[model samples]
Target chain A: MTMQNKLAWPKKITVCEVGPRDGLQNEKVLLTVEQKIELIERSVQAGAKIIEIGSFVHPKAVPQMADTDEVVKKMKRVDGVEYRALVMNLRGLERAEAVGIKKAKLTVSASPTHSLKNLNKTPEEAVRGFAECAKYAAAHGIELSGAISTAFGCCFEGRVPLEQVISVVKCFKEIGVSELSLSDTTGMANPQQVYEYSVKVREQFTDIDWVLHFHNTRGMGLSNVMAGMLAGIERYDSCFAGLGGCPFAPGASGNIATEDLVHMLSEMGIDTGYDLAEGIAIGRRVREFIGHDTDSSVLRAGRCSDIVIEQ
Target chain B: MTMQNKLAWPKKITVCEVGPRDGLQNEKVLLTVEQKIELIERSVQAGAKIIEIGSFVHPKAVPQMADTDEVVKKMKRVDGVEYRALVMNLRGLERAEAVGIKKAKLTVSASPTHSLKNLNKTPEEAVRGFAECAKYAAAHGIELSGAISTAFGCCFEGRVPLEQVISVVKCFKEIGVSELSLSDTTGMANPQQVYEYSVKVREQFTDIDWVLHFHNTRGMGLSNVMAGMLAGIERYDSCFAGLGGCPFAPGASGNIATEDLVHMLSEMGIDTGYDLAEGIAIGRRVREFIGHDTDSSVLRAGRCSDIVIEQ
Candidate 1:
């Protein structure tokens, strides 16, 4: 059978680097502000147009991100690159706006069990909190992108209902949040689920910007990306060195490696606007800085175009 | 915006275990004959219908597979599971038949440069050798499967043209070989290439069985499998513990992990008739036997359905 008409892939995609925020928060080592700044700057040099620099949560809660404020203060803002921070509450939003962060991402868990455990709030309470933060950020001239965590499935509540996720997205929309992200917090999504759910969500939220955040847990990260792309998603979140796992999800691996994702996308004739080699180098450096091996495959296996030169 | 019609995935697939041959050939450690027998037995227990037990080559060339004859001799034959060995020439076929091996795989390189470096023959010469082996195997009541190495791309010759690969397939068909496999020897294949090439090959060889062997060299192994499935191909080759890399390609990684493939397939609702947990256990054992970490993500992340119980 002729399959020329079956495959429909996007020609271009926007990859957001989330290594400095999500990656570092789950890391054991506490990078200094300078190191965090270096990572963000290097990510920009690697052609990342958007970087999630840090999260504005309580320092005592996540000590690894204690210097997030300082890191943002010292970071070199490159032209045309949007540096965003994650804000959980109104206080976090205030701190981000004070630091001159123009774009802030507000997240709430879709599953009540995960929300209670991670945020000490029910799903309703978390959504209410996000509503307050969204109002504050919008009034303060900050662009807000809302994220629904555990959108695919939750560790505490296995197989989170798609109805629950749709409700959360509806709440985000009700609160005037136009950009939204669905996070596979436990990496429990398969390609079919991703494709089916994304198709439904996109149909429901016709005007919102849809972003996908997938974990490499169970090894379906890039496959989920492909499914999302086929479902018409254009923005994705990845990390350098495949760093970061959900602290609440046991045995979770990192986010998809930025270099690995870029390598596949670039080879498939999709434009990612990132240098795969440069991303690999930064991933290696981050691995060294944290004194741990990363989950990146591209770092271990060079690019497909790499010529094997014999000595 | 509704994409429910574009994606076409197969409902069932056949996975062949090749860790015993392709996986072990590039390993530093050599398994005892008993250990090799146990692995093959475990693969059968894990629902592998076909297992490549060993390769009949010169012992000096690949010492890791030196005990091929002993392994086939001592292995317990399981009903419904077909055990096969790799035979490169008429002599190798004779050795396999002498040991009462019922099925054998004959391989030739599609690229002349790789054929010279790997088999010390031109592409035509290797095909001629495979033709001879096919004749002998057919007459001796042994089922033969022909594989084209470097069928996607080659390290020495760069991109092996699709015309070159098609020519090799034509030669295999002319030799009366109906079971054929195309190997991405260097792991240079992308999803688009796999989809397009597989569609073309399936169109030309409507009655032949086609198998895809991919390496995770650029981390596209499982994605390529997805592409192949979308293109209507049903058979794939995977290795336990994601073991094996090309000895000729400097930066090649292992074949797609059997457990990883099974995990994705099972989660996607595709039946491979394999127990994913059992396959993971075998992969873990193989990792211990080799005293090295594997490239399997499911081995690290567990299955998507695994419930993370909070401490």
Candidate 2:
């Protein structure tokens, strides 16, 4: 009948914020190194314990993330917080290790066509490269998470078979990689496909932790995230204001908007340990800073209960 | 795999455009009679077989839809096309019948608080009113469908209990209402709740033709629709450019965008016989006519495959 009389809210869920790295890299405006650090700090103050600080790509390739090392070094390290960086190759991993990035992510595309086109490597070559990165992460005590992009449907090669995605996961599994993050690179995942793919991956390695990475290109990003949550995935990667999109995936917008995701989770009584209003406010500020409208809807409209529209 | 090599696409998904009544009523813009008819005509050309043409309510209450009669009279009645309107009371029904409307929808909020606040009628009173209208439709050979709003969760009263929703559905069943359209008036439904409610409702009444009407207020509208689809609901209510929201429900947004829904269904190889590019172009044109931005994401960003991003 009333809020108090209804179901109690859910306990906090772990929210991995990837805006600084994943979000900024896709933007046209190349934020300076100081601005990136400031953004990361703001997200941390807004209660993001896991902040993806930056990436180790060459400045010529991705100028937005050129100062990954500086951004990672300058971020105010809170006690028990995890600072991560995107590392594509062994060289990138070495750079991340040098910069004290304790958690690093290595990505490989499951579709060989995409893998070759995106990374200039065959699937096997990409897997071996990530495997080398995984070994480097292991020796350096850095938490390594292998991410398989284009696991669902690929833009170049539509409807990537389940077997291809599984093989990539198996490759990561064989490489002694402890963590896996499956990405719907093109936002081609529906609930049914997400459920089926997640189940198949879970069946292979029951003990490993798998996180879901989704882009809302088809508007199913959050739906796929909920599907992943339903499939028992507790950890997810989201960008503030939904800031992440691959430059390679055209018409692909940001990842699931962090504020909307948190709002939905909090409303469902899932404890995300994040302040929703603060997140929304930060999301808005980032939009202003970026000088363009972000993909997040809740940020513009506020929560369902906040605005009172009269007929 | 190219589109040619991929699975056969689904064509011919029936879209029931509800923008004229359900959409404009929630918006601040109060279009005149001519504008409403213009929108309906454009929607009809876009291949919407079932159009919720208008609502017969007090003009002072819903100024946006004040010209219900003028719009319905101007409609070009095509064979196999159904133009419908919302009827709140016997007077509203009479008004629709006077306008030669052959199909009508009677809505009752499932939550008592919402029902009282929205319609100023108790659940029982609303049921009695709808029952009379159902009989009138039967006698006149006009079609009648019962729409239960807030069937999932209510913004005014937090989470709607499952029992209350079931009770309302049972009441609709007792009234011999064979066409039921369940609405998430406030977009408070999750996949689990939708799955449970749709299954329960379908299992209870094996013979009723059910459709899902959802608001994207909480970003779960499309996800909830997918849940309903999985539960075997084929017909759905949508608006071009996602242009519908309830003024009563705060942050209540446009219906699930028609073009976006069609895009997903077509990509999934489900037959929703609709042209996506044409639908998107129409959505953009309508948005321009409305002199405002729409909530539909696909319109702003072209189809995912259309983008040529270097990987």
Candidate 3:
């Protein structure tokens, strides 16, 4: 485990802002489609190259994301900016395609308990069911990637086995997805585990592009990001204002705060293509829009470079 | 910087909990001397080998720490457990000696502005003033360590120069202290800066033991800890319930939460010698005693290994 797994830190990284979708989906206040569009547009202005607008899911399950269609359709997409959306099945992909979402991602839980509780299917069933979604995406020329939730560990179950994660990755490979995200949906990931899993996966699937998603549920989100950076993974998923919560552990933090991540990356001399000052302002606006405080450090306390005018 | 950076992860680390002294001093409520003793005893019970009991500062300067002498005198000291107390001058050290405290720490700000504002002295003046305090400690057989506040950056002043920090370290060494702590008094430090500075100082002062102290002001506390660990630093300073507040950034977080650090370290297979459940319960009790929620991730949310029975 200590064979210099790597000390190579990425010079630059791509931050896929997931606040509009993954963040807002779990909030009590459902944002209007206009607000969602503004979120996407402002994120682009804040120098985010990729953003998850929203998810094409069943309205009953996630009422907050019911306007994903309108959000994708009404938003102004910049050329070279990747606008992604989450899809669960062929129906969801069909909806995303209908709204002209160029990138559609599918999520399956790495833990059987999570998969059954959230998707009403076991991990195997969920992975097998994604074949049709993959075929539809390939036929329609849509960029589809797979996300394995509970990749590190689960609250319902204890630790998710690395072999199980590998099997899920194999299934995603068989379905023809070139990019994948290993998500710490409940923030059960640590640095050693992240480095080990990241290295092991990169070794086994050299062809796949990896994206890391972590929750700050236990304050290890950015630490895990450091581990991933050391493991040579460059892409990460973050939420503006940290606007999500754990469904299993409610009131717990959700995703890594985007502004905080940008702040750290910029301070680390790792280019994140983000205007940290602008991003912090957007996070504040998000808090004002939601009419409640989100679990973001940058939103509560301004960026490190901020000039303290009065203190 | 691209050097392998020793990717050498330490097998175990020592967490010197500063919640009682550094944390409570910044708090509004003055915890009873009994409460302080209980906090120390319970921390040792939770497997903490070292703890900062309180400070021996003037009562008017810090009302919350006014009872520190009583706390030190009344507390039952466990053998083999290192108990530390913060002091500002010879008088404070004499008071600690009167209370039978064996270890005493003296702090000076690396930033000149902070030194003037807090201590009414320049950095050099403050460092020079420590000579008498060090002499008294040497005469009294007390283990004296130096703490440099705002070692990374200052709220009044921006980034402190690396040369200024090194000069302060040299001053501490000149004063006869063998251990020094570089504290990000306000959470303005990043992982890269931490790694570079830590490596630089360790290389320069091969005879000194270094402790990295961080606040979670911008959410980079744990990430900075990771960087320090990567830099081969095995000592850190953390608070119990993240109880401290930034005196400059009033509404911001103060120190890295102890249980959160323990949770992350334990998950990384880095032995911290903490019983996670006991530490968390103590954190909750501290919150209840303080009558407000602290800026702790693990306190708000259970540890990652905790199983959700009804979720």
Which model scores highest in DockQ? 1
Interface DockQ of each model: 0.52, 0.22, 0.51
lDDT tens string, model 3, B113-137? 7788877998878988989988888
Off by over 4 Å in 2: A1-14, A28-49, A78-80, A205-208, A245-252, A305-311, B1-14, B26-49, B58-74, B78-80, B117-119, B130-132, B170-175, B203-208, B246-252, B308-311
Please, what is the whole-model Cα lDDT of each candidate in the order they appear? Answer: 0.85, 0.76, 0.87
How much is the lDDT of residue A167 in candidate 1? Answer: 85
Q: Among these predicted structures, which one has the highest lDDT?
A: 3
Give candidate 3 misplaced runs (Cα > 4 Å).
Answer: A1-7, A117-120, A307-311, B1-7, B308-311
Enumerate the chain B TM-scores of all models. Answer: 0.95, 0.90, 0.95
Model 3's interface RMSD: 5.2
Residue range A1-311, candidate 2, lDDT tens digits: 11112121224567889899888888888887777777788788878888888889887898888888887777678878888888778888898989788998888888898788766888767887776677778899999877888888777787778889878877777788778888887777766677667766776678778888888876777777766765667788899998876555455567999998888777666778888888998888788789987777687556755643333
User: Candidate 2 at B185: error in angstroms?
Assistant: 2.3
Kept native contacts, fraction for each prediction: 0.53, 0.15, 0.57
DockQ of candidate 2 compared with the true complex: 0.22
Give the TM-score (vs. native) of candidate 1: 0.95
Q: Report how far off residue B286 is in candidate 1 (Å).
A: 1.7
For each candidate, give its TM-score against the true structure: 0.95, 0.85, 0.96
The better candidate by lDDT, 1 or 2, is 1
Of the candidates numbered 2 and 3, which has the greater TM-score value?
3
